[model samples]
Target chain A: MGNRTPLYEEHLRANAKMVDFGGWDMPINYGSQIEEHNQVRQDAGMFDVSHMTIVDLSGDKVKPFLQYLLANNVDRLKDKGKALYTCMLNEQGGVIDDLIVYYLGETFYRMVVNAATREKDLAWIEKHAAAYDVTVNVRDDMAMIAVQGPNARDKAHKVLGVAIADQLVDIKPFFMREMGDVIVARTGYTGEDGYEIMLPANQAPGTWRQLVEAGVKPTGLGARDTLRLEAGMNLYGHDMDENTTPLESGLSWTVAWEPEDRDFIGRAALARQKSEGVKRKLVGLVLEDRGVLRDHQKVIVDGEEAGEITSGSFSPTLGKSIAFARVPASVGTHCQVDVRGKLLNARVVKLSFVRNGKPCIDV
Target chain B: MSNIPQELRFTKSHEWVKREEDGTLVIGITDHAQQLLGDLVFVEVPEAGSSFKDSDDCAVIESVKAASDVYCPVAGEVIESNEALADAPETINNDPYGDGWIFKLKPEDEGAYDGLMDADAYAEVVAEDEH
Candidate 1:
């Protein structure tokens, strides 16, 4: 048996196929995963993302604590409700986790981390925050719902009150605002305009039902993965882990290197790695052959073991197999993937495959 | 509550078989199997003229979430394959018992076809898995 989320009953009622994901009994998909994926890409779909941990840090020194903890500097977030996507690195420069931090006030910052890394993330934050006088509060009472796609915001707004909907309409991208008791952020993983709403756990069922009645299709984790992958977003465990640094995980852009004096954790290691030069790189692969590309498949660059695929799948949006692979820096626009016993030809492209329901690369 | 057609024979691996009038055996993954695999994105069928022993893995089915093998119930030579699935893999999800038929084989031993499970026996096998 696995831990059940607040929306477990709601999922069961919707006839969802539940699976054990990171110790939680969550819906993989309600029905056809491809249809659900298309729903989020073309229409509106809602995901019960409550399994993700929500940690709030509050104290006068919270700003300094975050600046020292995350690789991305939070000093750029001057406005309230502004958010920053960053990776937390270990002392060895390997990624501990990737998270989103929202600045709510001068002394308060809220962060949402991956579900599988909850315990470790909380422990890391608490251990480092002791010297900064920041109190770590896990928001277990809240349940998160990500409503995404092209018409996601408008349909979701119909479920919200007029005043809240009006404010939500003006909330810029990567920004969030609290209305009454709910925090609505104009952000999503599907590379579409939408909102990630955090509300009381007890009210989650009612809100989900309201959204369903308003034409928001209930989706699950299966679509969430393909959506994020199509958008060229990196998943924490697959793309990078405690053994991989952000520099090799295609997350170097997220690292704030400016104001070099600001000492953050793993800063020295990252600087050293940068000075020495990174040997491998993360690139996208589009299979030119018939078979599907999958994780751990060997990437053969010029008949040699260049690297391996981190995440691969048949992209419903592109109608082809695509993957993220760590390969030698010399790898160019073409390569081959070893699927089963066949060395299938593939084309290397930019990290992103699809964005906003359109193919980012030429078909 | 997966549909187990009364007229067809089944394999323990969730494949369903129907003996055609011309002595060829048509096969496909059962409805219950398709339900378990979700929507299939790709189907790799064995080409005609390939020989296989009983219980040999004859085809591959891939979904967005997983990949599974379809085993041959009895020793046979491949006679034909459902080539339409190359363009529309979702046919298996839509009608696993009908148009979703995967391949046809000319059985080497006719008696081996009778050894396959009947609908009621296959139902018991499926029931055991639920627990």
Candidate 2:
């Protein structure tokens, strides 16, 4: 048996096929994954993402503590409700977990980390906070639901009522605002304009039902995977992990290094790698052959092993199979993905295969 | 009516075999197999002239999520294959027992279907797997 979310009964009512995801039984798909993928890309869809862990950091020392804890600078979040996406690193410069931190006030900040890495993340936050006057508090009482699409913000507001929904227009990207008890953030994982709502667990089911009744289609994890892939966002366990670093995982841009005096946990290791140059680099792959690109397949570049795919899937938006591969930094435009022992040619392009429902490459 | 047909036989791996009157056998992945694979995206059937032993990898069904191999339910030469699936593989999801059939084979031996499970047995197997 696995843990069930507050909306599990609602998912069952909608005939969602449940799958065990990190000990939590959740919906993989409501019916057709492809259809649900299109709904989010074309219209509106909501996802129950409460399985992700949330923690609150407090005290006047919160800002300083986060500066030493995360790879990205916390000072970038100058305004209240501003959010910053960053990766927490180990001493060896390997990524421990990637998370989004929301700056709420002078003494408090909120963070949502991956479910599988919750234990380590909590431990790391606590262990590092001991030197400062900060306190680490986990927010297990909140349930999060993400409504994403071009019209997602509009629909979510209409369903929640015009008075509350009207405030959504002013919530800029990577910013959040609280409406009554709901923490509505203008953020999303699907590379679309929308909001991620966080509320009490007991209120989640009713809120989900209300949103669904207001014409927001219920989406599942299957669509979530493909949508994130199409958006060029990395999956926690697949695209990168404890053994991988942000520099080699196409997330180098997220790192902040300016003041020579500011020493983060993995600063020295990353600084050394930065000076010496990185060995492997993560790049996007586009198939030119009749076959699809898949993960764990050997990537032959110039008839030699360049790298293997970290995450691969058939993109619903592009109608083709694409992948993210960690290849040699020197590897160029042409590569071959071995599928079923045969090398299928693929072209290496910059990441973000599909953005805002359009192809980044010229097809 | 959507259960495995009584006239056909099944393997433990979930392939269905329909032995024709002329000794030619029609082969396909069972409906249970298609359901497990989710939405079909591509089908890689064997060449018509290729011969295979029972339980050999004779075909492949690629879904939007994953790829699975379709084994030869009965050993024989593949006399014909359903090429219609190459353009649109969703037929397998819509009609797995009929239009979604993969290949036709002439059995090398008459007792090829004898060792396979009956329709009732295959249905029971699917039911048990649902747990």
Candidate 3:
């Protein structure tokens, strides 16, 4: 009863368990979620990310417009195809949405934002672009597929054929290359080496089938959540929202404050918060006992509620439970999580638990 | 269609009960229930000798997707709890009717097992839910 992506039929053919995700009926998993998670970590896997929104911004003032609009400096993208991950902030220093912008040309840039935040993001971009005369084009005719893992690139290259593969040989991480009508970016949400391919919507099913034939296992949104959580990536609406700033959401590194004169939106508020010091901070938690860490669980420090978990789940790779909690800056390494009326012991760790199919933290 | 053993009795909530020759009852979640919960990672079974009323929330099953409560089908005292599931919770997903049984219970009323839904009736419940 919801919106269906270009690959919806393919998902049904694969016996995927479909669920409503941000207004689109997408696959939660094909069969076992843990199996799909392990497949992506150990070998190659493909995901139907066609529901994501793609926008193209163009005009002579595009560069300057982005400089004022994004929290991260757009000047850092010096080369063509280079991508920068940044947060678009409101006037009050709250994060509107986080996105990746790729430098295509002097007057043109491509952006991929979260699907749920598409309408608001487009409205905000258009509202600010009027003064700069930048044109915004939403590419609804496109579909995206992400192929990930250690063997992901090789498997994807096999499906893309020799000519397209040859053009991507020199592609670096966070860089994109256009092969005829397709744009392949060496980037992905999963903490693995992969490419997120964007092409015509009608060609998505064929491309997905080709990748599957090449032995890339089809993954779903369930595995994507666990993989991204292990990668220490912040999911929109969960880790942070329009009410929270990037500084408090463990995303301080994404803010570019190098050019003190560059007065981007929310710069003054963030500067004030920086000078005053941020009281609350986001940190990672590893359950020391046998239990699953879930979202909205209260984080108890010394028998008092100090914070709450923003995102939590069982880590298939680690064989343990992990979570992201926003606690007082003074909270120590040890805390307890209120899991269904029981306070279980937990140890605080760095943001990431796994990377490159290996454990980043001590098990 | 999900596997529904003809010898077993079921509750509307998907718990299956099998009356043993000794009057003790073995209970577990149905195949349809495990399929709905996805891969089970953690299970909290009732302790042996624990008493519960009918329809009481007595056990917990946590999957990668969400945590679900296993309700007590009838008023009974637990005779034994399956401890193996603490280490291998996916046993329920693999063999829901046999080795994945959660607990053995001695019902308070001798005729309580007969009051539960039969295999054919439980099939109708599952069919109604699929829509």
Candidate 4:
């Protein structure tokens, strides 16, 4: 048996097909994964993201501590409740984990990291935090739920009550606000308008039930993966890992290079790689042939094995297959993918294939 | 429990076979098999007139999650393939026993279909796999 979230019983009651995700027994789908994926795109859908790790940092030196710890300069977070997406890197410039850090106050910040990387992320933060006397408190008592889609905000606001909804109206994208013990953030992995709510663990099932009653469809991790892939967001372990740097993983924008004087961990290595020129790059591929692209498939450029797919899936929104692949930076408009020994044609396009319930690329 | 027709025969790999009145065989993945592979999106069946040995991988079925191979239950020559599934692969998920049949095959040995497991025995195979 794996670890269970606060809403595990709720998932069981909904007849969810449970799967082990990062040591947690999580829902993969209820009946159909494609239906769940479509639900998030067309209407309100909620996912239990409580398996993610939440940590609270505080103390007078917290701001300075973060500036050196994160690749992206924390200085960009000027306003309270502002969220910044950044990759925490090792000394060698490889990603330890990608996380969202929220600026709550001068001496306080909150971070949500991947569930699988929880132990390592906590240890890495604690190791570097000792010198600055920054306190790292894991908020294991909290549960997270992401409500997404065009109609998600309205439906979620109804369940959260009019008072909190009034305050949420002004919360801009990538921003967050706290209502007593509950934290509502206008953020999500899916490229859609949504709120990721963090609340007391005991209140999770009730809140989820209320959201369901308000017509927010219950989504699962399977849909979440497809949604994120469509948005061109990289999964930490799949797209990049300890051996690959952010520069080659389509995450160069997440690395802050300005303030040349700010020496964050892995900054020197990233700078050296940047000056040396990155050899490989991550790009999106759309299968023109009648087949589904999959991970680890060989990407054939000019009949040579030039790259490999990092993440691939059937795009329910587009009615086709799309993928993210790391290939030579010189790769052009077209390439062939070796699908089970047969070569199939694929078109190389920009990183994102869909955003905001619409196809970003020509279908 | 998945629906297992009493008159049909099955394989451990989850392929179902029905002996046609003309002595040819119609084969497809069992309902239990389709349920395990949720939401079929693409299917690649062998070309008509292709020959295969018993237990050979003859077709491919892809779902949103992953791809799986459909094995030939008996040595046979493919007489016809299901072309409609090229556009509507989910028909297998909707009706695995009827319109979803993957191919029509002429067995090299007339009695090969009778050697496959019956519904009661295939149920035991599924039961064992679940545990």
Candidate 5:
């Protein structure tokens, strides 16, 4: 059995059918997944993402420590409270995990890592922190709720009360601030404008209830998935795994290689990859038909095995099916997906399929 | 929706088998099964005129989240299928006990229905699994 979250009882009250996800009991959905998916796109939706681990790294060498640890350069966070999305890599240049790191101050930085990869992420951080004299504090005391969609901010402001609402509205994207025990970050995974709030675990159920009272619909991992995939974001275990590197996983842009000399954990290996060139690349697939695309399904290009779909779904926003696949770098603009033994044609386009309730691709 | 009507019996796998007025049987997944699987997006029903063993998989239902197989409740020959559902699959979620039924068959043996659960027994099974 999976460990229950602080909001387990609340989910039960809401009549959610719980499922075991990465050792955490989380709601699959309340009743209808399509209704919940549509709700987030059409209005405000809130999700309990408290199972995701939040870790605080502090001490004098924090900046330099992160500079060497993350695939993306930390120097980009010039302002306090700024956040950067990055990949933590292993010695082999494979992605250990992709996380969002918030630059809290000169001495402190906060990281939100995937729940499934929490153990490896901590061990990786601790192993490197030894040389840099940094202290890593895992913040199990915090519970997170992500309120998303077009009206997410306004609804959240109302629920948080006027005193902190105004400040929250003014908070920049990827930045967060603490108002007593409530930590509000203007960030989201759904490709929508919203806030991912981290508060005391004990206060989360109340906050979630308050947001629902203020008109934010409760969503689960089911919607969280379609939302993120539509945004062209890669899921940790599916799109990319320990065997894949950022270069091949469509995350090359996140790696900063300036000065070409300052070495990070995966720098040498990635540089070697750059020199050798790459064979595979991640691209988006929009089905030309009604069928849903599924993960690991073969992608056929010119009757050859070009690649496989890493993530696929029937997109509620587009009213069609779409996918993200890792195909041969030489694979061109089109391919076919083997769905239930039939090869259905698909169009290959730039990665993101949707953003902010709109299709990213040109019709 | 109604208590598994006494005229019918259910399988442990959650299929309902109803003995017809002619002594043949009609089969479908139960309301409990459809509720467990949320919105039905696609369904591959066993083609008409197919023969199957008691435990054979007769149909496949695919939802947005996962796919499930419907097992035949008793040995039978598939006589007809719910062909209209091919275009509109969500009918199962709407009426699993009626129009949502997958197929009709000629039962090989009448004794198989006795192995299935009654209304009260099926409810107990579901309630037992919930907690």
Candidate 6:
């Protein structure tokens, strides 16, 4: 048995296939995974992201504390409700977790971390905060839901009412606004226009039912993974882990290097790595053959094992297979993947396979 | 409960076998099996003229979640393989019984086919596992 979110009963009512995801009994899909993936690309879809951990920080020195905590500079979040995507690193320059931090006020920020890395992330944050005067508050009573697609904002506004909808439409992307107990943010993992709503857990079930009635199809973890992959978003445990650095994980852009004196936690290690030259690079792969590419498959470059795939799947939008591989820096645009003892041809492209409901690379 | 056609024979591993009028045996995964595996992304059928023993793993079927092996119910040589699935594997999900047939086998011994379980028995096997 595992923990169930507030919408567990709703998922059951929709005939969802339940699976244990990172110790939470979450829905893998309501029905067909491909259909759910397509729905988010072409129309509106809702995902219960309540299993993610939310931590609120407040203090006189909260801004400076965040500057030394995250890899990206929080000093850039000058406007209220501005959010930044960054990696939290350890002393060894390895990722503790990737998170989104929203600056709500001068002394307050709301952060969301991955569900599987919740405990470790909290401990790291708390330990680092002891030196500063910041207070770390975990809001377990809050539930999150992400509604995403081309028409997602309109559908979400219809369910959330007119005033809130009007305010949400005016909010810029990667920005959020608080309305009573609900926080509506124009952020999404599916690379589509939508909002990620966080509200009291007790009020979640009713809101979910209303969204369903508004014709926002219910999606689950399976479709979420495919959608994120198509958008070229890096999953925490899959694309990188504690032992992998941001430089090797296609996350160098997330690290802020300006004002060299920022003196972040992993700054020294990253500086040392950069001077010595990074060894590996993350690249996207599209299988030109008839088989599906999968994780941990050996990547053959010039007839030798040069790398391995971190995430791979069939692209529902492209009607082919694609993957993310961490290969040697010298590897070229063409390589072969060893699938079940057969070497198949694949083409390397930019990090993302699809973006904004369209193919980012050639089909 | 999934649809279990009464006339076809079944294996505990979820493969369904049907004997053609020409004495060749046609095989595919059962509806219950395809439903459990979700959408099919790839299917690797055995090449024609290949031989296998009873209960031998002869083919590979993959979904987005995991991969599963389809075993040969009876010892036989492959007569025809379903090449159409190579381009569009979702046929197994759309029509798991008729157009989704995986392959045809020339059985080494006709009696070996009788040793497999019937539709009702296979249904019981699936039902017991669900609990």
lDDT of 6 at A43: 95
Candidate 2, A1-363: lDDT as tens digits = 787888899999998989988878989998788889998998899999989998999999999999999999988889999999999999988999999999998899999999888888888889889999899889988999999998788788877777777777777899999788889998889988889999999999999998898788999998999899888999888888888889999999889997778889888998898889999999999887766677788899999987999988788787778899999999988999999888999989888987777778867
Per-model TM against the reference: 0.99, 0.97, 0.99, 0.99, 0.92, 0.98
Better of 2 and 3 by DockQ: 3
Model 6, A13-109: lDDT tens per residue?
9999999988999999987999999999999999999999999999989988999999999989988999999999999999999999999998999
Backbone clash pairs for candidate 4 read none
Residues B1-131 of candidate 2: C-alpha lDDT, one tens digit per residue? 24678888998899888888887889898888887777777788899999999789988888878988989877789999999998778899889899999999988897877888998999888988887
- Against the reference, the lDDT scores of all candidates come to 0.93, 0.88, 0.95, 0.95, 0.87, 0.92
Instruction: Name the docking class for model 2.
Output: medium
Q: Point out where model 2 deviates above 4 Å.
A: none
Count of clashes, each model: 0, 1, 0, 0, 0, 0
DockQ leader: 4
Clashing pairs in 1: none
The Cα RMSD in angstroms, rounded to one decimal, for candidate 4 relative to the true structure is 0.8
For each candidate, report its DockQ versus the true two-chain complex.
0.84, 0.58, 0.89, 0.93, 0.57, 0.78
Residues A1-363 of candidate 3: C-alpha lDDT, one tens digit per residue: 998989999999999999999899999999999999999999999899988999999999999999999999999999999999999999989999999999999999999999889889999999999999999999999999999999999999899999999988889999999888899999999899999999999999999999999999999999999999999999999999999999999999999998889989999999999999999999999999998999999999988999999999999999988999999989898999999999999999998999999999998
Q: Tens digit of lDDT per residue, candidate 6, span B4-123?
A: 899899999999999988879999999999989998889999999999999999999988767889999899999999999988788999899999999999999988778889988998
lDDT of 1 by residue, B1-131 (tens): 79999999999999999998887999999989999998898899999999999999999999988789999989999999999999899999999999999999999998888989999999999999777
Candidate 5 pairs with clashing backbones: none
Model 3 misplaced regions, further than 4 Å: none
Worst 10 residues of 5 chain A by lDDT: A312-321
Candidate 2 has an lDDT of 0.88
CAPRI accuracy category, model 5? medium
RMSD per model, one decimal? 0.9, 1.4, 0.8, 0.8, 2.5, 1.0
lDDT, model 1: 0.93
